[model samples]
Target: MEIRRTPVLLSWICLLLAVFLIPGHCFYLPGVAPADFQKKDPLQVKVNKLTSTKTQLPYSYYSLPFCRPDTIVDSAENLGEVLRGDRIENSPYVFEMREPKMCQIVCKLTPNEKDAKDLKEKIEDEYHVNMILDNLPLVVPIKRLDQDSPTFYQHGYQIGVKSPHSEGKDEKYYIHNHLSFLVRYHKDEQMDVARIVGFEVKPFSVKHEADGKWNGDKTRLSTCDPHARQTVMSNDNPLEVEANKDIIFTYDVDFVESDVKWASRWDTYLLMADDQIHWFSIVNSLMIVLFLSGMVAMIMLRTLYRDISKYNQLETQEEAQEETGWKLVHGDVFRPPTNSDLLCVYVGTGVQFFGMLLVTMMFAVLGFLSPSNRGGLMTAMLLLWVFMGLFAGYSSARLYKMFKGAEWKQIALKTAFLFPAVVFVIFFVLNALIWGEKSSGAVPFTTMFALVFLWFGISVPLVFVGSYLGFKKPAVEDPVKTNKIPRQIPEQAWYMNPIFSMLIGGILPFGAVFIELFFILTSIWLNQFYYIFGFLFLVFIILIVTCAEITIVLCYFQLCSEDYLWWWRSYLTSGSSALYLFLYATFYFFTKLEITKLVSGALYFGYMLIAAYSFFVLTGTIGFYACFWFTRLIYSSVKID
Candidate 1:
């Protein structure tokens, strides 16, 4: 009886553990649980932020003088949503399931000068109004003739349009005062339930006129009337938005049954051009890897093997001394590199980044971080980075010990602060600019304090603990002993120059991922979904291989040239790829984006600089470890006595 009771208690504990360990979205099952609705059920339409690609800024939906609900309440947001400037709030627009309502009057607003100016600015900037229904974002569908699937989706509808004045003078702003909403739902005949799968809208600007004396009834409008069955046309006189002008807001809702299921409803929204480009990127990266693999194989199997054989066969000290190249520099090759402290910090930071990305990608590939869990990716990344401080400190401490550095605590402090400090300063400056612009993209003060707390209160203490543990362990042993006097490096050819070799080595790694980078940039800046974590993980692996191989190849060349200063060279070799990344970003900005504001341009470059710097550290660390391993292997294989 006691044994049976023990098993039952253990089983109950296991069940509770599983429930808490699983992702929040997993409870909902197949792609966010369906919200079932019966006929005539009230469906609340929630308004989100007004976003503009040109400015890369988001404003609240009610920032403009539009129709408002009696009491506005912001929805609860996750950390990622807050960081991304998503401000979702309850709106007055409500729809009934399977109910069609035409020419429904929402409200009327008379704009002041300030409101008119703000609306005009948003129109000129091409701001789009985002709304949500049943967790599905509203989109404007576009039909493409050349595609097999004829329709593509634009995430949100434009707030208004700037048109030339009737007299062909200056441009005038025309607000989209009327919206035609189409909600598509999947209905289960057996269960007698319906779930919304898609939300679409077609907006129009109608200068509505009242018949006879104007009443509060919407059927009295001449432009759109439900009783008369009069609908708003595209060619109807547009409503001009100006100071002291009345803007009548109206909408029509039509529900249609769709064949798409609740599980696969997000498919249409996530669709892009094709997977051909991704495959092309993979093939291109594979080609680089194959080429580098051939080079590395030749060096290892033929050149190094031959050198080792010849050296081992030498019976006299004179014969051994006659041999030149890498064999002559075994002593200085393991010597501590210049700026060892900085190198340790960078390597530690890279380890932190690598752990964060690797774990995040694994979770994403496992379907833990689904699109339904909005902002989960970013949130996971931040938390993972913070927790990875332990690894960062440990790695830095071990390297510092290997370098024979006396102050382990100093190095650990540097490792903990250097990288994050640079990032925080840049982020703070960018946030200040956004705040001055009155954009929702600016992180609030509370969030800022939270970030600071996560860094100092959590990450810093973890780093100190890791550093202590690492310092208590014995230092790593070098394969070859270093001499008291450093060997003078021989003259190197023009191609063997550090700058030339580093720049040349970076090209291969950059080529490995530039295509994938384009799609990533598009997803972030253009407000599209990026749910291809599997492919991204593959690319990431390929990128690591390419960086390591390129750096190893360059390090071999430098070693053969009798240059023992390979540590920094190895790092820079792969890290220089970031330079190309920044240059490509600049090119992308000019060609792909239509950013006209100086602030927007500054923001783009500033954020891109941070990305490039991180890339530099990540790739540089990969290269250093690869070269370090290569040197140890070769030096250990040969007789160093």
Candidate 2:
């Protein structure tokens, strides 16, 4: 039975190691559509004349164009041609942006009576208010280059809209907000000129810069709140047909010679569609899922199944000692945990937290919530933490009961206050440091007060209620009854020290994410983007494995030392992961970041609290499960007459 269980556990460990290598193993998939789903480029598109004075296209000059090919629609074309009016023989081909939002109609360079009168009529019709011609800016000339064409020649002029967010709001420009461009080749040289072929909206974005160590720039909109700014539109009629879909006019002209030629669109698009980060994430997620599944199966089959089978075989003899029923050692089980009372509370709180997190993650994976919802992850998790008040209260109260603590009142009071108080103290100190620096990262005084109010008003009451319920229930019964005279403990091995064993347990989980932590910090403080849910999920599995193995190993050592205080050890053994995580964050700030200000440092620690709390919970759950099983194993295997 032991051999079977040992192999199963080993198989799981081997599988975990194998999965950890997935980030480097997989290939990325190509994009299904253009980078942005819309007709416009997500990034700024430029068109420059080879002989032009301007180094880059001015925000004004480049106009978006719609091309009608005789046969197919061109959605994204880097190379385009400028053509002369009506004549195929002498027309000049100039490069232009084929995207609809890039399109613009310019007035003639030297206005005739027809041009001047037409301009006045067009401005009045477009703006519905008189606009001055002198104020109108001259267009610049150039062509957009794509993969096939490296460069295109200069031309007469180009026209484009000034961005909506340009320094001045009063400028008069006929911005085509909802327009998308498409190109379709003419079916025949003599058919109806050309019809609108493709449709899509323009992509837009505002500029942002990181400010100082904390990177809080109030001038820019928060990424956390995407809808903070307003967008301008071309028309007042909400139901007005969009430009790409609603074509107002069409005209046919002779085709002129252009340098651009059709290339294999597949190769062009595939190159642009690849996302390395997303590729890595998918592969990593697959490996971790397989790894964890294997580990879980091995543990259940080898250890748990064997223990249950052995116990079942002895049912007749075990039934004879009905008073025992495996947990006759209730007195020893309640032995006081060594070290500190505060640490006990801390570990218990962590256990409760981990329980909530697992349930939340499972829900998220099942599609109850998505990662795309910015704060939806944090918000869902916070609600789960609140709901777990019961577990915190129960674990703390029951452990205290086992310590021969007759003061249920004191136990209950401490159970209710300990975790919350520690959190508040840590938070208050960090906030004070932030307030001193006047950093944007500092929590507003009102917000701090509200947080306090929530803690006391909401969490404290729930915890107190949980404590009341926990104490109302009977203390947990131990499997083997304790002897009136305590048994002599055998001399422990050198590694049996609680501190030493715990340190070993922490290493696996920390090793799993030590490298990934830098990237996580970069995303948060350095303003780098990371949406690698797969890597995150893998780290999560590693944390579980580390917690369980470490706890089991430590529980064995504690049992050998005759320290029946395995209850608290089991909780704290895994929970030490939180401490390691906090240490890692501190190290990351000093080694990886250039952050100098104390407030940013304080905010960093403030963020660490959230991580620490999460780690504590996750590790705590691992310890609890491991110790629970270990205890059951020993009770079932030991000879009891």
Candidate 3:
């Protein structure tokens, strides 16, 4: 039976291995629709935003052409250009944006002038209450005499807006805003790219304007919230349009071209990080690592060694029976934990998450997932997580049966669905709220169905296959025999209590990664770029070492206290970092974010729960196995009759 089970499991593993390794027909990254590198010279601009610059939060922009494409609706790949963050709606302003014109149309007297009031109302309703440039993307224009032109990083843009009264009541007319590009150069005036230092912004809204044409008129407006307080005041001119003529708004996006080689674009971004904070965090984590390493060493070399030596020297059975400490607990050390089936299910899910994290990080570090690749990282993670279900099922079923459990089917079912269902439910609820807000970030119904199909079709069947094979195999061999009657656990001191120890044990692991956590949080919420996967991989290794070493040290202390309930303690001790992470996130929000909307706040914390839960499972899995191996090593070495 054991031999047969091995072949079945191997077959499944081989099949999956082939699937992942194979490229063309196996899997393709979905929903990545980044603009092509050099589609055309000066890509005809996309769209204008509907939201005002005065609004606090960022708003969506739409594609005027895609909404009303006339044989020029060029889109790449599977996604329609309109569906991919391109607010496609009918708008009168589309033409003004597409074909902006600067004209001083004098309202020539018509045979019988059309109702001036109706024309004014029509213009106000059609044109979106005047227009303002809130955000824009700029391309790098440089002439490098080296190899073929290197890819230039796009500059971030923010055109500021403001008014006269900080509170209310103000008198002003049509105001003017000017934009200037600030350029920086090396001491020698050499550069590969001329990075924009900043931009000069002036914002105002039209308080009033003439209805017809430029026939000597005046208007009202307000001024800035200034950057580089050098404003070019303009004489108020009667810039107007008639009802029957074509009205156009014209502006130029002139580039401040430079002739210097730029520093490596990647290095420029990396320098933005404060080095001191990273060093401080690294030193702090190292100190904890050294402390835990010393403690584990002392226990293994002195305490455990001395106990094992003393037990071996005892000649008579009575003398051996008198031995204590960890040697005495060997009989019940491998005893099945209370609710072993549930514990096994939990462990299995933890294994799955850990496995997915491991594979995803490796791929990221290997350069398979770069910033240019867009959705590659997330797509890879999702696929790997689904494929890891087989391992989850095998681990859960194998452990459950080892605990002398008979319900293999029950354990397998929970292992497959429990954690995933919880995450999906929370995600669906949050998505519904996003839909209510009519945000583009909302997952379409088709995408949701695709996710469900992936889960039911691939993950579930793989888990079932694994469960069958695991049940066919014999239970995992226990190093020490269990007694029919359970051993009575001794009362532990305050310091030795599971909760206290678990709390203390968690501090080190959390400290190891808190510095990196800050940068990650900033990137997500502040919308900054974060591409430090190489550094993150090193931190990941440090965290793994910290978790295992601390758990082992704590498990040793618990056994010495004559407490046999190491099962939950081991899991929670490392998993407790999730608690610290949650607390830190709360602190980050209060201190860092200015999020005012209740719905946004709810969405923030709701997604955070999912992240924290996954972290708990991943770290918990590492600690459990570390303790499991430690317990098995000590007990199996003792001379048990």
How would the candidate models be sorted by lDDT, starting from the highest? 1, 3, 2
TM-score of each: 0.94, 0.51, 0.72
Assess candidate 2 and give its TM-score to the true structure: 0.51
Displacement of the residue 520 alpha carbon in candidate 1, Å: 0.7
Expressed as tens digits, the lDDT of each residue in 198-254 for candidate 1 is 999998988887766656544368888776544585535888888998888889999
Q: How accurate locally, in lDDT, is each candidate?
A: 0.85, 0.44, 0.58
Worst 10 residues of 1 by lDDT: 21-30
lDDT of 2 by residue, 6-110 (tens): 444533443343245432111111111112122221222222211111111111111122222223322221111110000011111111222332222111023
lDDT of 3 by residue, 302-368 (tens): 9889888878787345676576677777778788888777778789989888888888775554445
Please list the residue runs of candidate 3 whose C-alpha ends up more than 4 Å from where it truly belongs after superposition.
1-40, 44-59, 63-160, 168-251, 255-270, 315-318
Alpha carbon lDDT of residue 305, candidate 3? 94
lDDT, residue 551, candidate 1: 86
Ordered list by TM-score, greatest first = 1, 3, 2
Q: Give the higher-lDDT candidate: 1 or 3.
A: 1
Candidate 1 vs 3: which has more TM-score: 1
